[model samples]
Target: MARLNLWRWGVFGLAGLYFLVPLAASVVFTVDVPGQGLTVDAYTQIVGTGGFGSSLLLSLELALATIAVVLLLMVPAMVALRLGAPKLRPVVEVVCSLPLVVPPIAFVAGIVTVLKWGPEHLSRTPLFQTFVAIQNPDFPVVLVLAYVVMALPFVYRALDAGLRAIDVPTLVEAARSCGASWPQALVQAVLPNLRGALLNASFLTLALVLGEFTVAQLLGFRPFAVWIVNVSGSQAQLSVAVSVMSLLVTWLLLLVLAGFGGRSRTTSRG
Candidate 1:
């Protein structure tokens, strides 16, 4: 068993190194180019330019906003499914996971076309206008929507597992016995139990959103990914720096989320 464990660790380390080799090469290449000779010029160039900063903030905002909206939609939807229609679980799960089946580029294209034409037909109505406004014309609303859709599966699965772990039937009965309403039981009991799941979903969503480039590029959003692409073309050094910064930011957000999640889990257990 010890030998087996050692073999497994060896395999895992090799796999990790294989994945990290490209990044290592990039860092070495950025530093070792003759005249440059181990300088921090790349980092300085990326940070000195205002564009990278603006794009970083935009990406952060986009991820946070997407997470908030997704949580709002997912939590109640999950609760309702869990409490009201257990039989429809399969259907609900399929619907939420549909984004994974569809090609992201195709999804973005379809959404963008519909949104573009929607305003023309529905221009006179306030509701239509509001809808159109929410589907941001400049940034990629389609891409953000795609992120939300992709995130649903993770969020739903996590919450579903959390709900199952809590012994929902007992909690519901206890809440009812104490004269607590359905909403009260859900808010005060179920939600607390699901905090770790929610935190996991949020961090995963953040990581996806931060690194996303295809949808943002396809939809014409000036997000960090797009900025990185543009910078890479004009200045490779600056682009590397910006990428490093973005990585750091992502790591920081993940750490914060994990910390809070640990506390919430401890509180829930206590």
Candidate 2:
């Protein structure tokens, strides 16, 4: 058993090293050279290039938009499943989880085709028009929508787990006994308990949105990932610097979300 544990730790350490080595090399290469031991020129050059800033801003916007949209869509549906029709929870879960089962390329391609080929009147509706306006494959909207879809599973699972964790019957009965309406109980009791799970889902969704590349690339949306690829192709040093900056930004966002999630979890337990 001790030998097995040692082997597992050894494998985990090697895996960590494998991932860290390239990142360390990239940072070193950006900072070190023959004559100059260290320099911030690479970073300055990346910032000086106007495209990097625009792309970074666009990526951040898309991530925020995706988070907002996902929460709006997922939270209500989850609440309904948890408090309204318990029998339909499984069906709802399957439906939301379908995105994970389907190949991203295939699913996105189908969505594109439906948007292009569906009825003219339907396509011309205000909602459809707005969706197209925000999500033109030629712009950053595709990235935003793709992020929402990809992050759905995380949000759904977190919410479902949260809903399951609460003492639903007891809360409902207590509220009823106290002359509180069903809606009031749900708003006051259920929502409070679910806060931790909701925050966790939001964090997971944010991380996924920040790192995604394929949908953005296929849809021709210029985001941080695409910018990284472009910069790498042209200037190696600038590419490394941008990559490092991107990592820092992503890490900071993740840290903020993690802190919220941790606090919420502690509150839920209390």
Candidate 3:
């Protein structure tokens, strides 16, 4: 037992170093200047930096939109598949997981082709406006669409695990017997049980949007990740500083989410 405990601690120490060493190095790089012993100028300048605020705000907006849209589409579909057509569940799972198999470069290339095609061929038609509107750089609804695709596998897995853990049909039937509609049952009964899964999916989608570079960069849109890279060319310290701060912020958000989820679960139980 003592030998096993020692080995577990050793493994944990190694894993902690593996993740923490790089983060420590980045912190040093940001704060430790050659002549100057330590300074926080890098962190201080983040807000004043060009495009920093807008890019971060844009990324948050994209993440929120992605979470809402993906949940709105996926939750109902998954529930229906589980209840009405269990056999089709595998087919739906495969379709959702296709994004994982597809390379980002290929995915972005396809998007680029479609965008170009819309303007070239569909010009002078009502659908042309539809294409033009989605590409608006201010919000770039196209990126939200792309993110929804990229997020499918994670969202599906989270929701599926949640659904499998709970008896969906039984819950729905009970709710229906009590004079609740399908939507009402889902909203009041089904979603409460799915609290944890929903949080996981939302957090994963947010992380993906914040960290993703290829799709946003290729689409010629400037979000937080691209702005960080752009900042690196001019101010390396500030870039690393931004990266560290973003990491901390993400961790803080996760903790808050976890706390909120826990409280909700406790309240539901009570």
Best-fitting candidate, scored by lDDT: 3
Q: 174 in model 1: Cα distance from truth in Å?
A: 1.4
Regions of candidate 1 where Cα sits further than 4 Å from its true position: 135-143, 265-270
Poorest lDDT segment (10 consecutive residues) of candidate 2: 134-143
- TM-score pick, better of 2 and 3: 3
lDDT of 3 by residue, 3-79 (tens): 99999999999999999999999999999999998999989999899998899899989999999999999999999
lDDT (Cα, 0-100) at 135 in candidate 3: 89
Query: Candidate 1, residues 207-256: lDDT per residue as tens digits?
Result: 88898887777767778888898878877766776776788788998998
lDDT of each model, Cα atoms only? 0.79, 0.79, 0.94
| Model 1 RMSD vs true structure | 2.4
In candidate 3, position 181 carries an lDDT of 99
- lDDT for each residue of candidate 2 in 1-270, tens digit (9 for 90 to 100): 999999999999999999999999988999896698789889878878868877887778788888899988887777776667889988888888988999889877876676565545466666677656756634556567677888887898988888788877688778878888978877776677777787788778877876777777766677888878877887888887888888889889888887876787688687
Q: Provide backbone clash counts, one per model.
A: 0, 0, 0
Clashing pairs in 2: none
**In what order do the candidates fall by TM-score, top score first?**
3, 1, 2
Residue-level error in angstroms, candidate 3, position 176? 1.2
**Which pairs clash in model 3?**
none
Per-model TM against the reference: 0.89, 0.80, 0.97
